[model samples]
Target: MSKYVLIGSKGCGSVVIELAMLKAGAEFELEEIPYLEPGPDRDRLLELNPLGQVPTLIMPDGDVMTESAAIILHLADAFPDAKLAPATSDRQRPAFLRWLIYLVSEIYPTSTFSDDPARWQLPKDAQDGYKRTVDQYRKTLWGHVEDVADTPCFLGNDFSAIDLYIAVMRNWRPGRKEFSQSFPKLTEIADNIANDPMFSGVLKRNFDT
Candidate 1:
């Protein structure tokens, strides 16, 4: 693709995908708009992403894609030079994909809920319901993380795209750091991946933007 335009938002898993694309040195352009507010840009993003969300990628030929996990995988699989994915010979593809899906499908959506009445809909009265829902989903996602705790890097020793996806997805908790600090391994990995140069500017671009 001549240009890879990325439609992303703050505190979203899309940041990881964009970071991976940047790390891979893939030849593509980034198109991200944070702050869920909309104008012409939001409308354009909706044209590509029916959900009206971020992590949308537009190819040079007008092909549009949504979903952060898929975006990261597509970039790595398409570019061998990037080496964001594992080798075909490796047998961890199954586990790698599992966590990738977990982050995208399970954890990413949980952030949309809020205990704060200022953030979500319903009413000041329904804030507790929203929080309860968020907790259930968050716990489920963490359980998935524990289930596959045996594997490092999600797909073995290598740092695949899944690692990047999870790191960004988990940043949503805000207080998640203090809470998940109990999980030593995950906390360590989070810190390690967060420290990578590939992700150095990603937090700023994706979260601070």
Candidate 2:
């Protein structure tokens, strides 16, 4: 079986990629390295990813891969029966790739900036500014995706890895319904993914574990 050593926190979006693997019914071993102790994970994932990011995939042949996008796309390729991705000849392939990359390159980065605004060092008076910068970017990011998601899903009628990544952001800001309200279609996609029976156990076991 392929061995997947995920080096991230429970709250990290990489976990959604892992969840997609499980949902695809792929056979793989699981390992977790908490983000709180990133050094050990960084050192450990060197063979898999020089950058030492989580959601790294170690193939059965010992070839390693890193980055959430690469990992999930690989999984989709490996599990053809799951059909998490569009076919190569499909007309939607181009648009799908566009949205998929945008989620990682654009939306994911914005959420990261806001998720932990306090990480940046600043004077007490400047802390609010850092936080405000995060808020501004978050809204900008939300508006971006929501505007483009004119259909049921980000990829326009297909539920791809993009939805999975966005759903994890629901808990990022926490304690406010408006966090998701701004992005109506994006939020609906998140809720659909989270509320699905296929993901019921994952959503339930996620926070509890």
Candidate 3:
């Protein structure tokens, strides 16, 4: 109860929060749930979060916090010295909020729906087309970000959690290779995060694949 407890899976959305907490020097323990397949751990996840999602955080006061954006924002607020996000009054704050919400609300759902077409009640025959279409749509979203992205970071010189978000998210669905080819600027940001001493180890461990 002295520190937060994060429930998540490897290479999943939780990696962003894990990196954020690490960057913040927060004391927390990670509980890995085997979300890729069904088992006891997943059952535990269901009990904690009805949606059975990863990155469900249990606060020190026994409160439950879900959603990656909220958790990362909380960490940023809790440990401003970590510089994981821009301050509320900072000029970059609007851009930070814009993209963070965009990642979770827009691009993230494509992966969620595509992960299991059955969940959305799409016909089995239509599933492939659904996944393909969403996958392409996701790239379009990334391209929008790419158009505005800057070197070594998303918002120009200052690095924020958005960079970490990009670094991790680009590795999903269409994957790193396609990501590099289509969005070179964002790829540079990802590469910067991957090479950063503070964030690199967690990225490698979570995304060893």
Candidate 4:
């Protein structure tokens, strides 16, 4: 089988794609890009994605795909039997798309900024305060999702890619303990995903727990 080539770094956004591909039982190879440092891996990654982002996927057909959400969605569509997402005709499709995009647009960027305050051009002394503010706002966003979330899963009984997202993201910012306390419902969803046989190994490997 022709393998999909996944370009990503450890403990980064690529964890989500890695879990999604594993769930789909897709044949793939992971190419670790040296994060932020210049070398052959960085050069190759830059050639594929100028943004220098992780989760850049090279499909079996040799086409390059970027963005975590898009790659996971494509994987779901390609491996229908895996049921990584709701079918387009399914009623839950709207909610699936809604929250997936919400996470990408709203919550993900805060991590981007907080992880590297220099990206926003903040001074060294102000960087800590900036990250705190971003982390607090992220908690608020989590609260909103938690309020609307269903037990055992983000969209209810069925497991979808959104749960994969929650599983990885909840581990970031203000720490998992704070996340669990601030948003119990979402924590349940993340916990469930973490425990699932399909995802457990990858989660452990990524988080190094």
Candidate 5:
């Protein structure tokens, strides 16, 4: 049996990877870290991941993996029975890769900036403006996602890791209420996943809502 260890923070994008592992029925140990400042936990995390980011997975063979999208995609491939992703030969595979990459590359960076605007080294007077710009961009990005979303889910009928990722990311920035109102289709997909028993526990555990 392959051992899996996930180091992550609550309310962070890492929640999606954690949920994916659970839904996959993959046995894994979770280590939570504090984001407030550098401390013992963060120090320990750096030893495994030089960047010290959460959702770092210590694989059974002792290799380390980072980035939420990469980690979940790996899980989906490793545990085919979990059905977290479409098979490479599946017609939806290309679209799946497209949206997944879009979320990580486009939307995910905004969330990071929104969470820690100071990281950008903007002048004090410019911080709020930078955040506002990022917020508007995030909203527009989500609208694009809504435009192409399939009914009942992002990939239609089936629920995959992408939906799980969207569900968690929706809770950030504009938050659930505003996010739902702005992007109804994407919100519907998120709502479905939130209500689903497989994901409810992880949601409550991370977001407490």
Candidate 6:
């Protein structure tokens, strides 16, 4: 069996994990799941993860892991040579963790809510408002990151999982064009990743860009 198995769908946030694995040169199998349509594949995914979420990683020992940020961090630490994250002793480690968690905790939820406003349980008539609110919040979160982003990437010149996360999220609501116009710095980071041979192929495979 491969060292790891990643269950994911195209264009999902899971693509960040996929790109991280590719950069790390990890030997892993990709299991594509139809996350939107209910079928055998989705059922199989649910069997492994009750949440039926993509980006579920199955270790060789049969342990299952979920969450895009956690999986990316795990891969970074597991394969130190890849330098996908800052070392624990590095001064930038704190900043790295901070932005990564902020993206996962603060910004990620906005995409979830915007994508499925009904999940918030707001009145049917209020669904559009919910989406708009989430969209505005996403822009606000990215704006804050832009203001503090001093380097070409999120954590200096080095390309880390944080950049991959930002690049993937940039494709979400307020899409690439609008997002680029609003936060050129952040867009530059994503563009750099999107243009890199190491990552561009994976990005294109997942997003068809």
lDDT of 2: 0.69
Q: Quick one: best lDDT, which candidate?
A: 3
lDDT of 5: 0.86
Tens-digit lDDT string for candidate 1 (68-99): 76676777778767667766676876777767
How accurate locally, in lDDT, is each candidate? Answer: 0.68, 0.69, 0.89, 0.88, 0.86, 0.86
- Per residue, candidate 3 scores C-alpha lDDT tens digits across 84-112 of 88888899999889998998999998888
Model 6, residue 150: distance off in Å is 2.7
- The lowest-lDDT stretch of 10 consecutive residues in candidate 4 is 31-40
Query: What TM-score number comes out for model 4?
Result: 0.96
Query: How many residue pairs of model 3 clash at the backbone?
Result: 0
Off by over 4 Å in 1: 113-123, 150-152, 205-209
| Candidate 5 per-residue C-alpha lDDT over 82-113 given as tens digits, one digit per residue, 9 for 90 to 100 | 87889989899889989999999999988776
> Mind giving the per-residue lDDT tens digits that candidate 4 earns over 1-209?
38999988877899999888888899999887665898888888888999988989998888999999898788888999878889989999999899899999999988887898887788999999988898989988888888889978887888888988999998888888899888888888898888888789888988865
Q: Which regions of candidate 6 are displaced past 4 Å? A: none
Give the per-residue Cα lDDT of candidate 5 at 41: 84
Model 5 clash tally, residue pairs: 0
RMSD of each: 3.0, 2.7, 1.4, 1.3, 1.4, 1.4
TM per model?
A: 0.83, 0.84, 0.95, 0.96, 0.95, 0.94
Q: What would the per-residue lDDT of candidate 6 be over residues 1-209, giving only the tens digit for each residue? A: 55899998888888988888888899889888778689998888889889888889998788999998788788888899888889989888898889889989999877776787777677899988878887988898889999988558877787688888878888888788899899988888898899989889888887777
Per-candidate count of clashing residue pairs (backbone under 3 Å) = 1, 0, 0, 0, 0, 0
In model 6, where is the ten-residue run with the lowest total lDDT? Answer: 111-120
The TM-score obtained by model 2 is 0.84
lDDT of 2 by residue, 1-209 (tens): 44555555566765786678777887666676664464766566665566555666677777777777777778788886666777788787777778778777876676566555567656677777776776777777777778878556777777777777767766665323776667778778877877787775665565541
Which parts of model 5 are misplaced by more than 4 Å?
A: none
